[model samples]
Target chain A: MSEPVVDTTHEEGETRLSTGGLGRTLLVAAGVVFWGWLLLRWANDWLGGLFVPVGQPFVAPATIESLGASIPGLAGAFDALAFAVEYLPALSEGLWLTLVLTVLGIFFGFFIAVPLSVARVYGNLSKYVSLLYTELLRGTPLLAQLFVLYFGLNISGYVPGFLDGVFANNAAWAALVGFILNSAAYQSEYIRSALQSVDTGQLTAGRAIGLSKVDAIRYVVLPQGLRFAIPGWTNELIYLIKYSSLAAFITVPELFKRANDIASSNFRYTAMFTITAVLYLALVITASRMMNYVEDRTAIPGLGTGSGR
Target chain B: MSDNEHTYLLEVDRVSQSYGTEKVLRDISFEMDRGDVTVLVGPSGSGKSTMLRCVNRLTEIDSGNIYLDGERITGPDVDVNELRKEVGMVFQDFNLFAHLTARQNIMLGPRRVLGLDKEEAGKRADEHLEMVGLTPQADSYPGELSGGQQQRVGIARALAMEPKLMLFDEPTSALDPELIGEVLEVMRDLADRGMTMLVVTHEMSFAREVASEMLFLDGGKIVERGPPEQLFDRPEEDRTASFLRRITEMHS
Candidate 1:
């Protein structure tokens, strides 16, 4: 005589269960197959070499020696792994140079951006002036700016002789200045958005507690704003790392320039270029991880979390 | 009107404010002594909150004078930051800094503005936390707190400033009905300690229980003002009587 019971509570879960597990498994399998295809295609030569029988002459040693002697400086297609191993020392020197430039560019750029953003947000006269500066820098290409600083200004005698005496004729100095100013314009925008994202009531709260406007901004507003800007700042930092390659045009002898030198000299363009690209990937990944750690530590619960970039 | 050369703790004379063409407060005048609690009761859009905001100069008066402890705060020469230190204000929305914990919120004013050392600021913060019975929640962020607890922390933050006069602008208006009692209780304790206070609120029961003087404001002017008992039991104006009747009926 008991009425049949229905379990409507479990129906939604059952429907989701039908699609979720199969979808996830298919996605994972597709990812694996895609990466497998990439590895097989890119590493075909190395994998084929590995399958070659040991002590079996694929090519006569005398023939290779004769070729090397006859051509003087000619080499056939490069083994990327072998090229990477042999020239690791030279590549590392250039990598260090790239790291140094990136560090200086981002450090100085961030410091400059802090004041620029503050001026735009809180200053009367400076806000418009900062806006103009930002527009000018952002509107032009970084390459053109570098050219203007290094070739145009350096040669035109527009810059003071004394200033040139301090920083003149140095491609590294020109590249650093160009990169810093360029990144500062971008970083300032990120920081400005962060400052605006902070609740206006926070400023009011600070003032209500008797803090002068400047003190409030310094102690209360900036701390929250800077934390909010971390993700965007890190993105800019990675961009700076990749952009450091452009310094080669000005003869900064950075990672890309060194790789180019080695590649041209050895005629191993594919190997050297691929290795250099991987190095940049490593640098960007390390920097992103470090900043993520910082973001986690400084995160104020419920305030800056879940804010969209 | 009793002018014997003694200054009240707060004095607002003919203060008026307008936005564009709309006058929010007009000729709002009131005075309170060192240990008086004056409650301003009015319907929504009646300029009660604006009047309280004017007292702390959170909103500037268009044409009037506001004196705190006999010092004219309305003068252009007066340092608004310095005046803010002596006059504490609690907002309607419990504007505690979301990034700061309750203790840090209380300590910021004393440390940064008052130049108190960290230890002294921390000590004062705890004292205020205890005053509001929020000592256990001192480390909680505003986002983690209930509405009532957050408002209590707001009060503690103001009290830590040790202002000469306190202003409460609808401090409990944003809280849920069940949570309103806790905030009102903390305020009642402050009134009992003879703190000079000006409050804008719709809690007629709290006003009747705690206010030494009650003001009924309509439009931009005070319609009636007297002791809470006299104003509630025997209104001098028909508008005041009807407003109170409407509020009581709505609450009941």
Candidate 2:
């Protein structure tokens, strides 16, 4: 027998490791300084372009008053805020495209991951196959995978015409497929580990109650495994959101791609890139919060006890 | 029925088991009639628990035949899951599903394996929980309950299956000394109600009061077997006498 188990509630206080608030505040300040320096360096050309027509060198302004004269609306109480708001409408289409792609990619990937993970952990014949699939997908980079499906298969004429008509016409579809395959590889690992973490005694209890092995896994093992997997799955979800920007390499016209086009044309690289960065940050934080809420809701008290400690 | 005829609810014939080169049981055999409560007493490392586990096929025997309700239970053709439905087991550890409530734990076998409707299973869970005197704790999870309550929930969980035979592998061993009686009290009541039970336990007093027969096992074989009073008062074997004396003195 193992050492006698100590009660979980008593150990919780000593076990918790606080994430210091001061460290996070300092990191935030560092990010602000970096972005501010980029903005000041590029402000002259960027502000000049908004006033003058194309192909013209508008006068550079040394003072706020002269800069305000360049654009009519810049004379407002908050010029920077006003400027960011004005340019926001142009990015909406690309932002919407990125959001849809991420949602569908993650949804389909998670759907595939559940069965693949079960097969890997439990199935006799399918276990080896699932193992190879996960290894091949996870071993390579997501960007390379996207390129293979988008350019190698579609543009190089390997894909049949009808299939190409469906997946090749849009870079977004190919990127979605890449995200699905990549995320499934990563998610399946998280799921398999979670399934293994559940106590073996639970399976014995299930079988003793006359449940067949499959039924035992379905009713007893899976619900607990899913709860345990939530924290890891949330990480995969956030990574998928960030990696969606890689779709821009294939001309998907996602948020990052639109930012690139807007910045290059307007000569306002700092402002456009900073806005896109903030939007991505917002998406990541919101997703993390939503998943945390789900983790709390599904947490079974006194179950999987002593694990956190 | 003829005078010579007796219905054997369970038969363990020439049962032998081994782990690697270590022989755990050697040519062990026993027969249990309906409504028999046979308590197996042995020192640690003896094959008492192994024999209990073999009855339900939890531990596969290397060479043996086990018959349950006169049907061959050890053969390849046996549906082990179906066989398990008729042979309920309670572990040394309570082994209740930690996440589920006591009521849910009891209800699971009936609902999932017996194919009882939810309402029917729910009602059966209530009856079984009451049988184990744990009706008040039905809504509590196993983790929240004390060792005794958890073990009772385990008993209720097995009873909800309504099995023909119940195997208890040191059911009270994991419990605290004070908590042992409540579990034993429930077992005594079960015996009174004619549940055929095979129990591996060191609770000799309970065995003396409730057991129809007693088997003293040592070195992976039955050293002595007979009625509890005969084994307790006038053991034929010197090893059995000393072992009984040692345990009795320890208890006193």
lDDT of each: 0.80, 0.80
Clashing pairs in 2: none
Top model number, DockQ: 2
lDDT of 2 by residue, A1-309 (tens): 111222324332221222566755664575566445333423533465454432232322224445666778767634555556555544655666677788888889888998889999889989999999999999998989989988887642444455555432367777888888889999999999999988887888899888998999888888778888988888898998889999988878888888898899889898888888887876676577567657666656565422331
- lDDT by residue for model 1 over B192-235, one digit each (tens)? 99889899888889889999899898888988999999888999
Chain A TM per prediction: 0.70, 0.71
Displacement of residue B228 (Cα, Å) in model 2 is 2.0
Query: How do the residues B13-40 of candidate 2 rate in per-residue lDDT, one tens digit apiece?
Result: 8899999999999998888999999999
Error of 1 at A64 (Å): 18
Chain B TM for prediction 2: 0.97
User: Which interface RMSD values do the candidates have, in the order shown?
Assistant: 12.3, 6.0
